[model samples]
Target: MTAGTGLIPVHKTDNINKLKSLFPALVHYGNSDMLPMHMPGHKRRADFMGGIGKYDITEIDGFDDLHHPGGILKEAMAAAADLYESDVTYFLVNGSTCGILAAIAAVTKPREKILIVRNCHKAVINAVTLRELDPVYVYPKKCGSLGVTGSVDPEEIRQALAKEKDIRAVVMTSPTYEGVASDIAAIAVLAHNRGIPLIVDAAHGAHFRFGADFPAAALDCGADLVVESLHKTLPSLTQTALLHVKSTLVDDGEVAHQLQIFQSSSPSYLLLASITQCLALMAQDGAKMMATYSENLCSLRQALDRLATVTLLRQETGFFDYDPGKIVFGVEGYGGRDIAALLQSDFHVETEMAAPRYLLAMTSVCDTKETLLRFQTALSRLCHGLPPRKAVSFPNMETVAAEKVMTPAAVRERTWAKRDFRESSHCVAAENLYLYPPGTPLVVAGERISPEIITAIQAYVEMGFMVHGVNDRQLFVVSENMSG
Candidate 1:
């Protein structure tokens, strides 16, 4: 597998010409105006600029509606569903967050019990609030050395479901924020045996379906519902995603209704069209492209593994399989935030996520060999003169307990309200409160804030990380008007 040969095959002149033809359709599709813009104020103005003005289109006659996609948009979604081998697929213009919300709402009824992994995205928490559903929280396996969340153990899920016999569904995140994948197949079987549906937040695993050597996708592992963020790892525009329904546990009508409840009425035709184009590209040549990408990732990892002061995380460290495209490296002596700043300021390289100990860099099929090599070169230079890092103490696992304050449905009725941080210490939270990069909430609404949570919040603030759901930059409290 040479650099520009097998995996990264050079596109023939004809292939390039075919790709060029797509531009005109995208441009012409933008000009099919039906009426004056009542939604997005842009109105196709030149001042809006770039792809925004050209693609920021609304629902019109010729353009099939989003909610009731019976025409071109539906056809596009069907094509994507076929590619993924799913029973049905819906185009999500509001990112995977909306898909997650819809999936939770579709699977569980109000006040029904659900088993959810604690490391799930805030969107899942929001679903719990909206449905007023009771959740039995399952903690992810902990990596003491890295202070990072690992995959959820199958046994834990089994125990939680057993304890809560009425659990309507189980939701988990495969290939977590740090790119750690779980035994999704085993968990799916467990859920199915208990007559419960399994919903997987595979937002970071969209590319898993493409590569043969990659970890199994949620849908392939028997999950009933899988939500993927196409833009995260694929060459699609941001906020373009797919929601796949695979089992009879969830009806198509219920899922569709939930989608309508959560999704925007006037969806972006540009985003919908991009989903089609991305799926087409993936169906045609995804395997070949991903093979090349995997080869590059292996090469890049090997190069980074040899660095003295930096430790590149791999599956062998009791942490299971990882997404090769996600390059997570720990700077031995320096803080991750400081290293990220240095890379951005001095080396002109920006990373995806930065924590106290490690930084993440996401690679895609679009990444060039030169680009990766450049990142490696910058890293080597940065590590040359770094000082010894202080040993930072992270909170113990026992301190972070799941406290159920209200059902999912009840939490939803309380609109997200903002208050002063100083006044919010004891208030019930209405929104997710956590750091942006990792997006983990320390205190969800309905749960009282413990000293440990306050400590975590203070640590984040001291590290220059922004803490959401706080009032006046001092303390964070939950919203006052919370549902029962």
Candidate 2:
């Protein structure tokens, strides 16, 4: 009767009370067909846990270990670090990319240099090429003519820690993923006035500190590692993540030994019981469900600001805050994947990323208002008779040339090939390309691919946008590397 007891005895102030769920072992093997020899080749069936493989589990005996969580997964990560205030919290079943590779390998070491924040998140450049560190970029400030990407200029992180020298940490990407919010309490006082340590990917801000209409949660604006992604906007489950540790200038036992060396020594007690039932439903009803999801996202941004060919991109996108559950529409003459494929073919509505001039969506508390009034009656019946589009400005994708020439540990000791980079150039790049709903790279594998990074991968392959590190249009570079 133990594996997290509760067969129904809730309300310790219910919002999923008394934090149970430490592997309900697929809810005690659901209607017990009891057929498991185990070692998950998904024998829990229901066709691969679609019905939740009878609580998809493993670490048996009273279900403890998530790399040392004691009982009830350290009381559901200390009630999700007291509902995200954080001094510690770490669950992350490999989502915020193994908590940004264990918060950039528990704060820099290898070649130590840090400071990133230019459109970040390709798991912070694969945690600066697996902690070989030395990055230094910080840019992001676009938002005008809304080609998005904003925030991060705490005096360019106090002039890159006063002209970079022995700098050790810093990384940004707050509400971004189209919600943009930086100035985490003035870049955590310019990296604790140079004792460095910022680390904030805040994975699309796991519902930004519950809410004051979003933007504050980077461990209450003084980051020292963050990484969220509770299924990107809560209601968890789907690579549920957390990883917090708010400062002590990051050393929570080397972020639990770099989350036991980048998580998954088999840890997904059903994604840690969906991140402890999304922090007990964000501590029993997250602020009246984030103030009724910011009053149905400010009445769906005043009905998408009276349509007239749509434009919404709110909170004056220069960011210091902006996450009205990340809306971002902008459609004049359409092309955010043709208005997300005309609302996924006449209103199945799906959206949450599209850019080449907007589309994003999001909203939470598991959204409803009759599916946002059937998406405001199919976006005002697909902007009625169309043809208005005159606003153009949303394409900048910052930071392209910070001059590397080498050291991503000498571009992974070269040797590569590939070619046809649209009639090549000063080649050197061997890969790190870009464009997968902002994977943000544009040449970063020992860089030098110039011709303005082959015209930004030929304008994201002539805007049909695909570009993820060469294959057709080839371009891998580094063949016996002569010299750029």
> Which structure among the candidates has the greatest lDDT?
1
Cα miss at 284, model 2 (Å)? Answer: 4.5
Give me the overall lDDT of model 2. Answer: 0.74
- Candidate 2 C-alpha lDDT tens digits along 378-450: 8788888566767665445555555676756567766777889876678677677777775867667776777
- Please state the error at residue 365 of candidate 1 in Å: 1.8
322-376: candidate 1 lDDT, tens digit per residue: 6767787778767788889999998999999887778888888878788989998
The TM-score that candidate 1 achieves is 0.87
All candidates' lDDT scores?
0.76, 0.74
Backbone collisions counted per model? 23, 5
lDDT score at residue 346, model 1, on the 0-100 scale? 89
- Where does the lowest 10-residue lDDT sum fall in candidate 1? 1-10
